[model samples]
Target: MSVHSWPTQSLRIRTMFASKAAEPALWRLLSIVTLLIIALWWLSAPRDLFSAPLSVTEIAREAILLSGVWAYVLLTLAIVVVMRWRWIERPLGGLDRCYRLHKWAGIATGAVVLLHCVLEWLPGGLARARSQPSADASRQLGLDWNAATQEMAELANGTMLCALIAIALLRSIPYRWFRKTHRLSALLYLATTWHALLLLPPQLRFTPLGALIGLSALFGCAAAVVSVTGGVGRRRRVRGTITGLEAHNGILEVECTLAARGLPHRPGQFAYVCFDPAEGPHPFTIAGADPGARKIRFVIKALGDYTGQLANRLAEGQQVTIEGPYGGFDFRGTAREQVWVAGGIGLTPFLARLEYLRWLGRRSPSVTFFYCTRNAATDPYVSRLRTLCTQTGVTLALVDSARQRPLDFDAIAAGLRDPSGAELWFCGPARFGATLQRAWRTTGLPGRRFHREWFEMR
Candidate 1:
């Protein structure tokens, strides 16, 4: 027992460990740490490093102004590159992770960059910098202007614009335009790196710490390029087609079948499907299907920009490109008692799960389902699932929020044979899952009993 006199069960902990989307959070945290280290170093030093006299505040401010703007922009561009690089997103589970890391890294970098601008940049210093004695010692203590410095500064400013554009299109932005502009940012990162290296005077060029940072940026750029070129060891392509399209409950349902490339998949995993080469492919969960079969299918509901068009535009036998089958929702790796939570179209992955179970001719080994939706009017695959539960003896509890309903958590728990050992699976919107998570935790289910899936949402 680590706390509260409750025994710590790693099984539940392990079971509960699901994938997380990396947002722009981590880069911010790292940036804060850098500030702290700078402060401590400044306080302990006998003399300032800048050669000329400048207070800690002024020095910090100037540092921010110089690094703050470009770091965020460059990092954002790098993120675009990384996202573009993950062609083998599904089998290796790289695409999802890449998006997350890039997001978090950008967020982190974005924050730090802003702070560097705010907390560190000396306000309106262009004039003051010009007034400094030209004859003063060639000490690199203050902001200096030169061809190299000017070029780097311009590149940094350009990259910032690139990042802003990237963020704007994070969700609703058309995929093609975003992809092309993001590549420009990648080239800018490379440009900045070269610019930085060239400007480094003999004194700081090869310093161990400086070299390390440079190396990291270099490697990141290379990795980004490789991923884009299928050079980073990602599968070059996933060819598939729209096997069928049907409208269910006023939402369009799309069925896609892929020719297996011996790509490994697990229950709760998803694939990116394309109806037109010009239109960006979207990630849709695999409806329960046979992995061994030459073809596997996905069920998608008309939801947004790409998806809303699915029902009307894509036809049977259209050639499509798929980018992934990425996710950490695989249930086969565990042996814990299971509880699956689904919301709206979130149940698509479980369809595949049930199919897999059927193929093996085995019961889902102690499973319970708690599905939430707006109302029965929009439940995408109710008919198929009802038949499935009846045949498999899988117990289902439906919660419709549109009816102003609260999920019967206690009642659901009451039926669980081993609530403490049950592995809970959840997939839905951010707020819905978070609310359910808190409720489940309050009810004393093991932490592992709640697993949430991360999908792309604006």
Candidate 2:
């Protein structure tokens, strides 16, 4: 069926349903489970929760404790998901999407933790000010190691807030410091676990809420152990040495030959690379892979401090560690005709796909590749791509954004022989992809037919 044949209402309905289906199933499941747990916890609580009048301080205290429980659960789940990304990558769509979820979970956890602290402390502060006579007796009664545990928990909470704020706001912080601070969260999490164990309301000890919290604590403990032992991505890590380096306008291509054991990866997947222990692991798409030669290549753009310094600091024989081959942006199981839109550095995955098609030595699919950049003349990879496209019989159009208007669905549809049957793949800035997706909506295209890779980790 042609796209033009669909009625407007039908198209709208189809798009609505497709968009709903496109939401990550794993994320939806996690969200539903979390909400269910929260509801159960509230329902299973004592009758006084809803039947009796409660003071503001008592209500706030309950809220603070509940929020802390939720935050710890989410934080632990985020750590487990991120550390074992491969397990969720396929179901979650891609590692990029998984990381995006991981980031959201982390931020949400931090915000809730902050809220818990404020709610717990504000009432105490006001109460102390209103009644100084009882403060001394209260202090005397609260003293001892349990009080110390509460203080330690508060200290850990403050440290976590500081670290999260620093990492979020200051990109220029030394990578080593960033990594250490990030890992320190695990230790702080352990401290909070202790606090929760000893200080949780005595009434909840025999209830389901307590069991759920205990399970979450166990999960968090296990994740912390894996993190502290550096067990993340252990199996995926492969030793390799840089064999060649090529610099292109603001991009650098590093070619590396791996050890005898190959790092199996599909086209359009990326890996986290660690060149220096201090610099930590940074993700880059695999531009090309040669299984026979046991070699893989990465196209890195000088967009940040660590990447900008790579060209200058990297040597030919420098050893590196690679951990992945993650992402599910592969163009398989789609329509025979595919439209691929790549923006600037976004071209890396397409290049990998093209290389894979060439290696397969079969007739290429009907693909229209629109490569968008500032200038086709100066883009170092354009010439290489042109040659590869010609040899592989893939249609290539270089769209110089400086000289031409941005690409729209109409422009893309002009080249498609069967718009309804063609899948659209996009990798670029999130805003650009959204623009094209909106355009696709008006063209009566199924939203599922549009595949986009979101590269933003933050």
Worst 10 residues of 2 by lDDT: 126-135
lDDT of each: 0.57, 0.77
| Model 2, global lDDT | 0.77
Q: What stretches of model 2 exceed 4 Å from their correct place?
A: 1-34, 53-58, 124-145, 413-422, 437-449
Regions of model 1 farther than 4 Å from truth: 1-58, 61-94, 118-162, 165-172, 199-208, 227-236, 257-262, 291-293, 332-335, 377-380, 401-404, 408-419, 440-449
Clashes of each: 17, 0
Q: After superposition, how far is residue 58 of candidate 2 from its true place, in Å?
A: 4.4
Kindly list the per-residue Cα lDDT of model 2 for residues 1-458, writing each as its tens digit.
45654574355344433433344543576687579668867865788777878877657656766777788787776666666645566777888777666665776677888887777668455322222222343456766545677689889878877776666544456666777778777788789888777666666767888888888888788878888888877888999999999987879999999976778988998898999987788889999988888999999999877889899999999999998878888877468798999998999999998888788875464988999999887788888899889878899989998899987778999999888888899998655776787778678888778888867543
Q: Once model 1 is optimally superposed onto the true structure by TM-score, how far is the C-alpha of residue 94 displaced, in angstroms?
A: 6.4
Residue pairs with colliding backbones in model 2 are none
